[model samples]
Target chain A: MKKLTTPLKVEDLKDLKAGDNVTITGYIYTARDAAHKRLVELLEEGKELPIDLEGAIIYYVGPTPAREGEPIGSAGPTTSYRMDSYTPQLLDQGLLGMIGKGKRSQEVKDKIVEKGAVYFAAIGGAAALIKKAIKSAEIVAYEDLGAEAIRKIYVEDFPVTVVNDAHGNDLYQSGRKEYLQWLKEN
Target chain B: MRQIDAGLITESVKKMVMEANYFLPEDVYSTIKEAQDKEEWQLASDILDKILQNADIAKNDQVPMCQDTGMAVVFVEMGQEVSIVNGYIEDAINQGIREGYEEGYLRKSVVGDPLNRVNTKDNTPGIIHYSIVPGDKLKITVAPKGFGSENMSRLKMLKPAEGLEGVKDFVLETVELAGPNPCPPIVVGVGIGGTMEKAAFLAKKSLMRSFDSYNENPFYADLEKELLEKINELGIGPQGFGGKTTALRVFIEYYPTHIAGLPVAVNIQCHAARHKEVVL
Candidate 1:
């Protein structure tokens, strides 16, 4: 397993390969469908974004409200493809990585390669376990969006697997292929 | 005739909703444990372990097992000999969901309007299905459905000539296309031999059944086993990492259909399969 800290740089992602397990620490921002739409709209309107894009890793999630004394409720990655339309634009703004589940569109994969960004997959539906890694979470923007609101969260040892790396390798493709090959041989 | 209090229904539903969200049903939890034990792929096995751990945490901490506590889908079997007093059945059920979501700290995932996309905020107005059964008792099952798997569900109307092979093909295709999106190891719900909507409903209701149970019909039971094997053969594994356990079970629910059409619906349920019921 590889260990990474957020505010990630291109150099930090250069050596990563598809299928490598990763545990990320430091701070990451949360944004889902509605928040991504708003972020891209602000970029198009030439307004300053509420959060910095440079070296930032966006976690696609919409957590349940935190119970009293809890930092956040069950927090897990949402499906990534819904945000595909706005992802390239975010990458253009120097977004370094995305943490979500499921496969990304080819266009998003191409942009990840072009922009030296990475894509990571958190185990979907493993929310309760994943929430233990989050040390603190506070809504940073669009509170009206409720759970879809953008939150900046501090995490320690947040487990993820490298799905798409800067070199354009995709684990979803290669991993499935390898498994099928094993099935054939066995 | 027995008169049931609407308030009582509301209270029961409220508790059921919270329990459904916070607890992973035993059949699903055990099947996942079994899958983890059998999974040979290192990555797939680890992912399954995390899923099991998440369920344990959710149960112990009394938090939702998944962040998408889901749009509440309630199934009601009301006895024809019983009448609800004090309030309308629908209103009482909605009230129960609203209170449960608030009290449980479950995410309210419903929208007031699909196009306008405004949060309902209370998770009220659950999609309710009602049937009149024989006795004077009322039964309610609350199955909160997360959209990650819901989005991957599909329905198709096939020509009668296409037959059973066509149904099998479509089920495989839907799971293959869904890939990792629905969060395997998924429970495959197949609804066949109904109208378009009925097929869809059967597929969904099938998900409420326990993973270890099979369709009563021996033919369909064998078909369920066949489909489950084929799906795992696709190597979607747990979270699509690829392995022997892409699907924990396949359920088929069928009804008599018109002579001209065979409608099939595939409802995929993620490993966080949750449903709770109460009888009154």
Candidate 2:
């Protein structure tokens, strides 16, 4: 697995092909459907975004309530396709990466290549395992959206597989081909 | 008639909700564990390992297994001979759901209005279903429904002439179309032969059945096995990344239907098929 930091460099992503397992550290922001919508609207109106998009990676998640003294609650990626409409808008703003589960639309895939952005697939439904990698978390915007609010979270060795890389490779379609081929051969 | 305090139902629901979210049921946990051995894909096997560990953490720490702790879905089998005192049964169950959600720190996911899009905040007004049976006992089953997979659920009305082939095709097609979005290694619940709504309800209800349990109908039992194999062959694998196990099982529940319409519903449930039952 490759080790990289967010606000990623072109070189950092260039060598990373689709289906390559990765462990990303450094700052990453969290946003789901509601937060993505508002962020896009802000961009359209030429208003200041809550966070700088120039070198940021976004995760689609809305965590549960944290108990007192906990860093955050069980945090996992929500499905990615729900944010498909707003993704191109965010990608245009120099967003470098996205972390979530599921397949993306063809339009989203085209934009990922055009804007030199990447999409990563975190394991869906393994929230507690993912939560252990989070070092800290704080809401950055859209707090009124409840579980759909925006939050900035720090993670260590946050595991993901590159689902869509900037050069136009797609893993969601390709992630299982090897296994299927192997089964056929055996 | 036996008198039962409504408040007792409330307390039982609260406990069940907490338990359902925190503890992965035995059937689900074991199936996932068994999948690790059978999974040929490395990534799929790795995912199964993490899923098993995630359940352990939730159980030991008393935390929700997933962030989407799920919308409370309470299924009550009410006895006709019992009398509920001091409150309505539904209200008591909702009261328990609110407490479990708030006190247990589970995420409140229900929106007050689908279009207006406001969080209900306390997660009240659980999706409660009731069936009146013969005995004087209340059997409450708390099944927290998560939308990751729920969003992928589908229903179809086919011509009676379409027959078994159509039913099989629809179920397989729904799972294929859902891909990784519903979180693979899923539990597919098939409700066939009912009217549209009843079919959908049966599909959701089938998810609450343990994976190891057999359907009384031998034909459906064999069909379930066939469909399960067909799904795994899709190679959707764990979390849709690809693997040997696309789904843990396919459950079918059927009822008598009209001569003209054959309705089948597919309710896709995530690997975290959490449910707890209690009799009061």
Candidate 3:
């Protein structure tokens, strides 16, 4: 598996391709549907974003409350498509990576290519296992949103797969085709 | 006739919700393992392993299997001969869910209003379905319904002329459109016949049944097998990573409907298929 650290550069993501298993360390900002809307609203109002996005990676998640003595609860990736409408704007803001599960819209994929960003798929329903990689988490903004609030999370060796890459490789397409071909031949 | 306290109902719901969210039932666990063994793709295998590992962690840690522990869906079979003393029965169920979510640290996912978009905060007002049945016993089952797959669910009002093949096709279409989104190796709940809403209810209810459970009618049972095979062949696989196992099971529940209407609803449940029961 490839390893990457946060505040990722264009060069860091440009070489990544779909289907590569990656271990990403460093900070990934957590934002789901509500936080995305608020972030864009800040931009519209000519205000500073809650967190700097320059070469930043964002993870789409809404975690359960942190139980006593734990950094966080089952903190798995939520479906990513809900952020599509607000995505290109985030990409434009120098966002370099997105960690979540599921297919990206064609529009978002195009922007990922344009922005030299990568979309990584974490295992859905594997929250507890995923939480093992998260070392710390704290709400960064939009606290009223509860679980959906923005949080800055520190991760170590967080597992993800490249679903869409800078060079326009899509694992969901090629992986399925390759698997079907293997199924047919074997 | 025997009577039970509404507080007892509340207690049952609390236990059911906690246990169900914390543990992956054996059927789901084993099915995932079996699929992992047969998976041809390396990624699919790895994903399944992680899922199994997550379940283990949740069980051992007493934490939820998924972060979106989901909105509590309580299915009640209340005896007609018994009455719930002290508070209303619905209130009791909601209270149970309130305490369960609060104490367990399961995320309170319910929103107060769809448009206004306020978090209900305590996960109150569970989606409850109640049926009046024969004796003094009350059976409560809590299935935490995550919106990831619930949002992918669909209902179609097919004409009688469309027949059985149409029902199968609609379900397949829904799964295909859902693609990798519902976190596959999904459990497909197919509700056939009845009016529109009843069909939808049955679709959701079918999800609570055991994965190994089959329709008593031989024809429907065979159809279930056939549908499962076809879905697996789609290569959507686990988490839509593509493999030979797209679905773990397909369940169908039917009710008599008006001659003019042939409604079918497909309720998709993710691999997290969590549920538990308490009989009081």
Candidate 4:
């Protein structure tokens, strides 16, 4: 239940360990498969990204529609593995964190260790709960992509678990392997 | 013949869509909560805690349960005695889905072409299955199916001699192949009998059943119990962290198949398992 309330800067990520549980507050950017493609292209061409990448956390989500009187609709994390191809590129640019579910590629893990970056997984399919932490949201870019459009979201104490760390440790595999071994023995 | 109003049907369907996306269904919520209480593995328990937290966040904030809100899948049961008053039943249902996705602020996930990959903005042209049964009411079950579990679904056709043992082996192997990728503590819907497609349909449709409810047929009920025990034996656990509850429940739906074939389909559902039922 470690709470992180302040707006995190890129340098602040140096303090986060691989297994530490964190609650991220302040402005984070939303990008899914499509947005990631565009962002990576921009980086390849040596062009500036739409937002400052340094110390920023990226959440992989598309979200359902919002009903009346709601700030955002069912907003939950998508699988992070889908974006593994583009993640290292972003990480190279000082991108400090990522939020989603499931495993990552070896290349991305290497980048996380090479750079002082962290990866966190918000609960999948808990969009409504995640939305409460979002104080405000605005489409930052790629409006034509419909739900896949890039948006910047502001939040207070958005919760996540560090699935991968700067040291290249992964919780998902370790957790699964331990259980499988235990099952074989018992 | 009894005539059903298209407008009224659209309205109810629209609400169902919104409800399915907005509120996490009670049975699913309770099951996850129950898993948290019963999970033996620490990692599994921790994953369950995160899922519960996700549920809380979605309910309190009106956010979606997952990012891949899923392509719109609707099962429509039309009474044999009924006819639509205004438009075709499929059109009306698609209209309701469009309205629901738009008004509810949910994701529009349908694509017009698979290879070319063009987005169908409204999430329209839903995957609608229509079946005519006894009475006059039209029933719709909306499932916001995420791709993670959907990707893991499998169907196999076996020689009639293969029997239940073959079915059991295939079902277990399917889950084993899926591993933690589909997100564990999966709800496995096993559909046996009928043609290849029907078995697959029954498998997907079986997922609509309540998590804890037993199948109506006694033999099938027993089968559900046995399969559930074996699935848990896999130790895939919560989110594949490994635990006693590899699967929360096993639901079986079967019909008489051709004597020559034993068709079986296993539709996997992650813990999120968002689905809703409505009658219009």
- Candidate achieving the largest DockQ: 1
Give the winner by TM-score: 1 or 4.
1
lDDT digits (tens) for residues B155-227 of candidate 1: 9999999899999999999999999898888998999987999999999999999877999999999999999
lDDT of each: 0.93, 0.90, 0.91, 0.79
How do the residues B1-280 of candidate 3 rate in per-residue lDDT, one tens digit apiece?
7889988888888887888889999999999999889886887887888889999999998888998899898899988888889989999999999999998889989889999988889998999999999998898889999988999999999999999989989999999999898898799999999999999999999998887799999999999999999998888877887887788999999999998989999999999999998888
Better by DockQ, candidate 4 or 2? 2
The digit string of per-residue lDDT tens for model 2 on A1-186 reads 799887787667877899899999988999998888899899899998989988689999888898899878999889999999999988888888999999999999999888778899998888888989999998888889988878888989999989999889887677778778888998
For candidate 3, the per-residue lDDT at A80 reads 92
Over 4 Å off, model 1: none
Q: What C-alpha lDDT does candidate 4 achieve relative to the native structure?
A: 0.79
lDDT of 4 by residue, B25-93 (tens): 788888878878977677678877767777776666565666566777898898888889988778888
Residue pairs clashing, model 3? none
Q: Is the docking of candidate 1 incorrect, acceptable, medium or high quality?
A: high
Error of 3 at B80 (Å): 1.0
Best by lDDT: 1
The digit string of per-residue lDDT tens for model 3 on A1-186 reads 789998899999888989888999998899999999999998989999989999999999999898788888888889999999999999999998999988899999999999989999988888888888999999889999989989999999998989999999888888888889899998
Residue-level lDDT tens digits of model 4 in A43-103 = 8899999888877788888866556665566577777778999998888787888888766
